[model samples]
Target: MSFSLRPQPARWFELLTAREDLTLAVETLARTGAVELETHSETATPLVLPDLRGRLEEYNRLAQHYQHYWPQDELRPSNLPGRPVDTFNHALQRLYAWRDAADAVVRRSEALRGELYELEMLREMLLAQGDTPLDLGLLAGAGPALAARLFVLPPRTHIAQIPAAILHTSVHGKVHDFLLAVGPPAEVDLLEQELTLHKGRPMHLPPWLQRGTDASLAALDQRTAAIQAEQRVLEQQLTALQEEHRLVEALGDIARLEWFLTHVEALPVSETFAWVTGWTSDLDGKVLQQALDRAQVRSLLRFPDPPRDKVPPMVFHNPWWAQPFELFARLLGTPARDEADPSRLLVFIVPLMFGYMFGDLGQGFVLLLAGLLLGRRVPTLRLLVPGGLASMLFGLLFGSVFSREDIIPPLWLHPLDQPLLVLAIPLLGGVLLLLLGLLLNGIEAYWRGALRDWLAMDAALLLIYLGGLGLLLTPYAALAALTGLFWYLGARLQRAGGDLRVLGGALGRLLEYTMQLIVNTLSFTRVGAFCLAHAGLSVAVVGLAEAGGHPLLSAIILLLGNGVIIILEGLVVSIQVTRLVLFEFFIRFLRGEGRRFQPLPAPPHKTERT
Candidate 1:
């Protein structure tokens, strides 16, 4: 259950602005830290003007330094030190500028190297072509013949005579060239038979052009190497300068801290120093209290009385359970009072549902261990420890270890092997939880002095719940008696003597109440569904492992299966559990909008004395 906040107005005045006598009175009252003070002045005196001006000048100088080193903001936090806001801004600027300069240098170097390589390649190709004035047209004609024979050509020209006695030309280009024998062979009669014979001629051409290409390539490589070395030197120098700048900026923070302390020490005794001042029409005493508490001071002042409208305070005791419900409230966009404790509900349902959803001992242990390690590193995962523990507990109950039920004898029933028990537990848990909500609702309504609501909404709900239980356990007669009593109390609470309007409202509420009962009960069905899903997923993992022929493959399958269950099923179960708590449980009992308690400001001198 949550408490309501009563906000009141409080205004505080410091002695520095008052007349001598009023100043003395304020100082005397401040000694007790109980009385609120008020003083009005025509004008306010400036405080810390010199210090502010000095800090601003320091900030500007630092900003200029940052702009020089880093023109673009790509520096990581590890590169910077100190939390001085002004100095940090300047450092970031410098880091970005330095990065931009480095990038530009690298880009220019790469572009130059690329162009040099392309020029070198062109020079080599030219050299390979040689000085010969060979007929390129003849070379083109002989290209196909050279390609077919897989022969190389020298940079020269030659001629050949065919068997038909016709002349043909052949030209050798830089890479390759060949001749074409287009005429038919001659026939000679010898040894009583006719035979056709022709002889083909071959010629060799030496490659003189490749020598010049090698020299040009070598020169370009040397030039590129020198340029790269120069670029490296520039990069090293920039890095060193940036490091020095970072150190100086860090030292600046220490200087600023010293300056702040010096100014704080210089303030007059018995003088009121204002840290902050603001005006608001709806400023509440609670808001002032919160500010003072955060400031860790005992004296605070505010104007006008706080608003008296009855609105609950906002408190986040259990963020894990409360956050999801808060989202729902925002969507509804209307005020609701939940009288039950969400933290307790979360405590009960989250782990229970998770256990049912993930009921394999080996996998549950893995989840528990992972959750524990993560909780150590991250504060947010701390809440999940209970849920993990619950999963392990349920896994033990189901007698499942890594989806195999043969590891241990069945304690209750295996989810896959015995589906009935799986369904029964969730349904039973839901009915009981709903009844618990109705009980809380009745208590809350009675406390809030809404007897009519208590008897009509809560009492009728109780009878309906009990009557259902009775019918389930015993006979229809027991249910009828309870039902008659529920209708009588509801009708009386509605004041439905003869008016149709009163009777209609009662009937409508009764119907809405019944609908809530049905929905709340059905919501728990997810518990059984998740249990089956957990069992089925584990079975699939085992199946995949069996399908893999290799021993190593099976191990990999098991690893993957555990990983998937922990990440995927773990998230789904968490969400489902959260939904059950927020919708089913909270809808019945919790009221959360309560303002938090805040205190006042205290003088530094007084703090030291305490």
Candidate 2:
């Protein structure tokens, strides 16, 4: 029912083009987004693009500079902007002009920022002087011979203990305050040591103070106001460039194209022709060829078997309904090239498990509506629609509506009424799922030429599972035991080509496999456990609602309790369902270790001419 085994197939390709046509060829490949250039292949050599690197750095710098000014969530078409991508020389010319304009504004803004910082510092220091009567200019001149110093002291410091010969004044503040003191150079030095012991710190006057505190503060404030006005004008000019975003985008695209050209490794097959080899779909290779032909770029395309060391990139081929579940598989990892695609399997099983546990018609209806609303916006939430529908079906069978079991006759047994069945059903399902996983693993192993894995563990496990299920009578059980025993001993025989020392490893693996089978099957019991918990929780809420003395109070309690059960339990169940699918099901066989295929980024979509 799923595309678990059907993945997109790709063929390796080597594209040869003239040296002069290399850029066009590469651009064409990038635009098609079909070819994955073998950057690691011997033919792929990094190209030298000094000019491109410089331009990329410049464009990146400019983008960061104006990023804050760009409008958020603006509507833009997927294709390239209306204008054509500019040539390198032309783009550089525009970049230079834009950079020059932006640089001028940046320079003025920085200068204003520096001036404003100095002004603020001056104002703070002057304010710290408190309402001192001494003229700041006089204070500056006083420090010339006998050094006048500003000392900040904690409130608890004993200022009176200082030598009386030193002239001093104190102003109390929040945690600490200023102490303006003056004395002979040597005496002031001795007094400073005493202040350090009391946790006092010294403040120095700014070099520009040439007048009284009040006059200096007033002058700094005026300068700060002027600088602020200038900064505002500069910011406005920079923000105005947001309208020219398309130009900026074009610059970025051209820079990236050039960067790619520099980094891509291509083999020079001849004096004039350079070729890059990579894997792409047959259809995509034809598309790339056509694009190159139209550009008048000479190219040779060929398909060949990939080298043994090379692992083909995996591309999932699934129906539209199963596509969303692929997101879940991708989260764990992509399937290995030779492994099965589990997206369809996940789609079928995950929702089924969730519905079985979270059966409730009213709540499921609400969930279905929520899923529909959110699915349009969030691709991952789309899975919830099918899951909700499953829950509604189970709810109908259980004859439960908003936790009131008595509201309708039971089409199936209630969860609390037959707790053992609840537990047994999930365990049985879990065993079947495990067997399915083994079957799939065996199939994958055979395809991958892993005969040992196919026959030893998966095949043996299949027989044991079937035997446990009471299939094939007494001979089946005896054959399953014999197969498992042979598998346990087969590891020793296969180790290092039948080395005796491998006996230890063989025993360890056998134990590990046996334990895994037991634990995996038991893990499904949580499904039934959670199902019963949901039913018990519903009953408890209903009991509370019925106990309320007033009918209105009972109605209110019932409504609130059902809402809590639906929202809170629904979230918890969803997480648990995902966990079972991933750990209990997917982990059994899904390798998910394959690297994702990365195609070259395409140019912006080009708008059609009317």
Candidate 3:
């Protein structure tokens, strides 16, 4: 298991292959789940690539059109990367075949659906007439001599305009007036023009529906049932068609090949060959090399010293228990290849600080349970398990449970009882932690062969800080001045060009660093302050519970109070822990200059498929 203190390692490789074998080389490397190809921007790309890209563009458009039908799962490439033209053409052929078979059914289905909508609307208008006789033979367009029609007039239309000679009956609806009119053809036609002027719509039943209201409704229902049955039959036909053509799997193949071609198109190539370079995990590099030989690809692979020009990708190899702590370190970024990885350290540091601020046994168990229930879905909350365990440990020390102190005796003094000691302890711990940070920086500098430079600047800063802390606990008042003198000489000799003119500037820099050291050490006091706040909140909750009038009332208040403190204080304490760990601790040594490793994904394993 690679721990945080040890650097993650990678092996750099370069590959030279005949242009034709380039596809197989990529395939081998990719399928082995290794190799990040580096592009040489200076190398001239060959003509073959542009043609390949142009062809892939067509498949890309086709993919977009059918993208909704693609499987939700991962897609595996069905074609070798070398045959870019063939792969795209194959995808196009399958898509066109499916579209040919499916289009007719789709169009018919659409037309049938449109007809069904109109039939349903007509049925609804008939039903709304409600026990009133609907005689299509008597309505206008059906009557031979005297024309009769149902004119749905707008609510604001002038009814006085209806000719007194015409026979009419009216029914008022919420928004329109339905009027049945019988008159000479000429007069009814004139009335039609007037209703059209008022922006009113017309409703008419088919002539065949001249049967009484009950019989017309039955006929409408029978026709509706037939149309619905036909729609169901079309749906089944479409499903069978989709299955026979394997439309979804065709889409998956098309998508997979599209992804493959895009990745390989950026190679650094000459007229006849391509060069691929990248860093790989050592084991994967060996596997890729072996696979190339087995596949008889005309290629040469070499494991070379890491490139000086670019930062090699970093891969963290940590034990399972320490894995979750990676989230904290990643908040900043991957650690620089030469600097420290903070993940393992956080395993101890984060939970300790978190537990110190939120020391309660029952709440800790609640968090632990929550982590168990939800950790898989929400990865960040996985920290809750370790944090809760640490909180339980601290709860034992502070003698608190469910915001009550009477359940257990203190293994250590309660924060409220000796707030001074609570405040003082973290300060001392802070001194040690800050000292450790400096040491880690010194160690990193030494690893990089720059220890002398670190000693010149950071070493002086460290001594001055220690001397300042010494004044509080020991007889070392002059120690600060002596360290300040050392800083002056070191700065002048190392960075100031040995000029006396910059003396004030150097001294000012020292004073600035001195204040920073003091402030950074004091920042840990917030840890103790939050601890006291938690204890006080617990006291208030218990007090409220005691003041309640009835036993049930007290229980309710106590339960509710515990829940609020658990959620609200839990969030506050987590934020504090992240703040302290990130800004306070990590800034001491991490520069995050390394690149994260990204291996080419293998062809995804086939999901449910033909």
lDDT of each: 0.52, 0.71, 0.75
Better candidate number, 1 or 3, judged by lDDT = 3
TM for candidate 3 is: 0.77
Please give the range of 10 consecutive residues that has the lowest summed lDDT in model 2: 75-84
TM-score of 1: 0.53
Better candidate by lDDT, 2 or 3: 3
- Count steric clashes of candidate 1: 43
Per-residue alpha-carbon lDDT of model 3 for 1-610, expressed as tens digits? 2245755766788899877566656767777666776654566354254455676676577556544443455444443434445655666677677767777776777777776765655555555566766565446355567877767666656755788768887666555567777888888888888888787655554555655768777877787788789889877877687567665555555555555566765667675677887778753566877878876777888887766666777777677778898877778888766788867878888898889989898888899999888999998889999999988999999999998899999899888989999988887887888887888888889878899888887887787777777777777656775865677566776686777777777779888877777788889999999999999999999999999988999899989999999899999999988888777788888777777778887645332211
lDDT of 1 by residue, 426-451 (tens): 98998888887677677666656786
Best-matching candidate per TM-score: 3
**TM-scores for candidates 1 onward, in order:** 0.53, 0.64, 0.77
lDDT of model number 1: 0.52
Q: lDDT order of candidates, best first?
A: 3, 2, 1
Candidate 1 vs candidate 2: the TM-score winner is 2
Q: Residue by residue across 1-610, what tens digits does model 2's lDDT show?
A: 3335746655677777776556556667777777777744554555644365565676567667754443334322212221212344455555556566677787777767766764654465567665545565566566457778777677757854878778887766555666778888777887888888888866655444555667777766676777788888887887665345344444444644554455465444454677777777543466877776765666787777787778788777677988888876787888876677877777778888888888888778888888899998987778789888988888888888888888887789799999999899999899889878877777678668896766865676566556555543465577666666676577447646878787777668766876878888898999999999988998998899999989999999989998998789888998998788777777777878777767766644321111
Clashes of each: 43, 8, 1
